[model samples]
Target: MKAYLILEDGSMYEGKSVGADKNVVSEIVFNTSMTGYLEVLTDPSYAGQAVVMTYPLIGNYGVCYDDKESNRPWVDAFIVRELSEFASNFRNEDSVQNLLKSNNIPCISGIDTRDLTKRLREYGTMNGMIVCESSFDMAQITQRINEYRVKGVVKKTSTEKIYTLPGNKKRVVLMDFGAKKSIAKELQKRGCEVIVVPYDTCAADIINLRPDGIMLSNGPGDPKENTAIIKEIKKLYDTDIPIFAICLGHQLMALATGADTYKLKYGHRGGNHPVKDLETGRTYISSQNHGYAVDESTLDKNVCVPAFINVNDSTNEGLRYINKNIFTVQYHPEASPGPGDSSYLFDKFMKMMED
Candidate 1:
């Protein structure tokens, strides 16, 4: 069936429909990863947005259960240049088309992804709608696109109830702000008893749990908008518990400590980003998926120090608190569907807990 991706600016691209027959309106962004489309689709961080794949071809290896970052796909829509014709992987259980269709996600193919990505890079991400019908009213569509906004996405994606995964080592209270499953798995692999909690859980309740360490998981939406979460984080900080955070959690941590954050031009959304460690003077290839970054200029150097920076853009990637057992990184160290170069950070968190 014929489909159209209409942006709020009135720009339209025609394509062929490949997933479920549904219309979707949401914030549209792009990813530059050459592989791991499955992981990208299921990542909760993409909760309120449609993703444009900058890579020419997607789903060449097909889909498998073990590759999922979350239980289900969270992307509102998927846009790609071309969908692979054949599923050839030995571990393949389903095709990407079937996976999205089963999840009732709208997908479009045969569009110029390069041009789309370039536009987003130049003009920044915008609200968009995916129409799968034969014909539609352009005026109404543009109005809907312009009026739409992504809000409360973190609460929608976060876990509804607290759950525990038992282990024999140190106890960790993982506050899940729409966390990827791999974050808890990484902690469990190291023998940490993981207690996953919702995004709005209070700091006093967390303290009552008597955790050896605290983990702030990645999530969706603008960091500055989550004012309540930031306040709770400040209360958590007063406890002096060893804390480790990733992606959105890192931004919230900075906000809790009185630092400010700003939205990026197009934001980092690929697996091959390079981040340099300022402390050790080493560079590591990292996996990242975020739209906002901590503003280094707004940081209080007396309380926190920059730890890692992006090699491509020199943006802040990691930070360490002076005289405190707290640190956070702007990239994914678990690497569920990307490189494992920075996985040692998990061990670093464990060492902090040990001390």
Candidate 2:
């Protein structure tokens, strides 16, 4: 079936449909990763958005359930230049097209993805919809795009109840604001008893858990919209136990400490982002997927300082708190689909708990 990706700017690109025959609108962003399409599909951070794979060919390796970052896929739509219909990997289970159809995720293939990515980069990310219907009014589609907003995504993606991943060394309370499974896996690998909690879990309950450290997890959507969560994070800030945050967690903590976040022109979403550690003055390739970044000027100098920065645009990538064991990074250290260069940060967190 024929499908069209219609942008809010009235641009239309036609492609062959490769997913469920449904119309869906989303914030259209592009990722530059060469592989790991399976992880990108299941990542909760892509919630409320459509992902355009910049890589020309996708799904050659096939889908491995174990490589999924979340239990299910979160992307509203998937756009790519070419779609590999066959699976080739030894660990392959199902083909990508089948996965999309089963999950009701709309996908378009054989489109000029390079042109689409350039448009997103030139005009920033825009609202777009995939329409497989033979006939539809462009006026209504554009209207819907203008009215679309990514709201309440964190609640939708977060865990419904508390759970524990057993480990022997340190008791770490992981507040899941749409956290990836790899985050808990990383903590478990370090011999830490990981307690995963809901998005609305209060600081007092977490304190009652008698945790040696607190983990604020990565999530989706505008960070400022989470006023209540930010207040709870403020309370967590006062505690003596170590705290580590990633992506949205990093933004929320910065907001709790009087810093602000603004959306990037075209958010970083890929496996090969380079970040430089401020203290060490060394750069490392890091995987990242977020639209909002902490405003460095709004950061309270005495409360926290930048620990790392993006090499591409000099955006704040990490923070270190003054007189505290707390540290936060805007990029993923868990790196389920990216580089493991920054995985050592988790070890540092374990060391903080040990101290």
Candidate 3:
């Protein structure tokens, strides 16, 4: 079937519809990763956006449910240049088309992804719509695209109740603002019991659990919209528990500590980005997928200092709090579809809890 992609700027492209035959309007962003489409599809951080893959071809390796970061796909739509029809990997359990169709996700293929990516990079990400219907009013669609915004996605994706994973060592309370599963898996790998809690859980309730440490998880939407959760995180900062945060968690911690965050012109959403640690002076290949960054200049040097910065844009990547057992990184150290260069950050958290 035929499909059309309409951007808020009035740019449109015609393509072949591949997945669920329906219409969807969402914030459109692009990921530069050449592979790991499965990981991108399942990442909760993409909750409020439709992802555009810059790679020329996708579904080359097929789908593996085990590779999913969440219980289900969170992206509103998937856009690609071409969809592979063959599965070449031994681990392939199903085709990517089947996965998207089964999940009722709208997708468009055979579009000029290189041009689309260029537009996103040059103009920044914007709201767009994927329409399967050949007949539609352009004015109304553009209006919908213009008025669309990604909000309250953390609540929509967070766990409704506390979930526990048993372990033999230190207890960690993970604040799930739409967390990726690997965050808890990393803690479990280090012999820590993980208690994943909702975004709205108060600091007193978390303290009542008597955890030795805390984890702030990655999520979607603007960081400033979460004022209540920010207050709770502020309370978490006052405690002695060691805390490690990733992505949105990293941004939230910055807000709690009197720092500010702003949206990137064209966000980092790929695996090959370079990040340099300020203290060690070493650079590492990091996997990142966020459109917002913490403003390092707003930080109080005595309270917290920038620990890492993106090598390409010089934006804040990580932070270290003085006289506190707290650290946060804007990239995914869990390394779900990216590199393992920064995975050692998890060990640092474990050591802090032990101390």
* Candidate 2 per-residue C-alpha lDDT over 220-289 given as tens digits, one digit per residue, 9 for 90 to 100: 8999999999999999999898999999999999999999999999999999999999998999999999
Tell me how far candidate 1 lies from the true structure as C-alpha RMSD in angstroms.
Answer: 1.0
Residue-by-residue lDDT tens digits, candidate 1, 264-350: 988999889999999889999999999999999999998899999999999999999998999999999998667999999999999
Per-residue lDDT tens digits for candidate 3, residues 22-139, read: 9999999999898899999999999989999998999999998898999999999999999999989999999989999999999999999999999999999899999999799988
lDDT of 1 at 326: 95
How far out, in Å, is residue 337 in model 2?
0.6
Q: After superposition, how far is residue 118 of candidate 2 from its true place, in Å?
A: 0.5
| TM-score of every model versus the real structure | 0.98, 0.99, 0.99
Pick the winner on lDDT between candidates 2 and 3: 2
Name the runs in model 1 displaced over 4 angstroms: none
Model 1: pairs clashing at backbone N, Cα or C within 3 Å: none
Model 3 misplaced regions, further than 4 Å: none
Compared with the true structure, all predictions reach lDDT values of 0.94, 0.95, 0.94
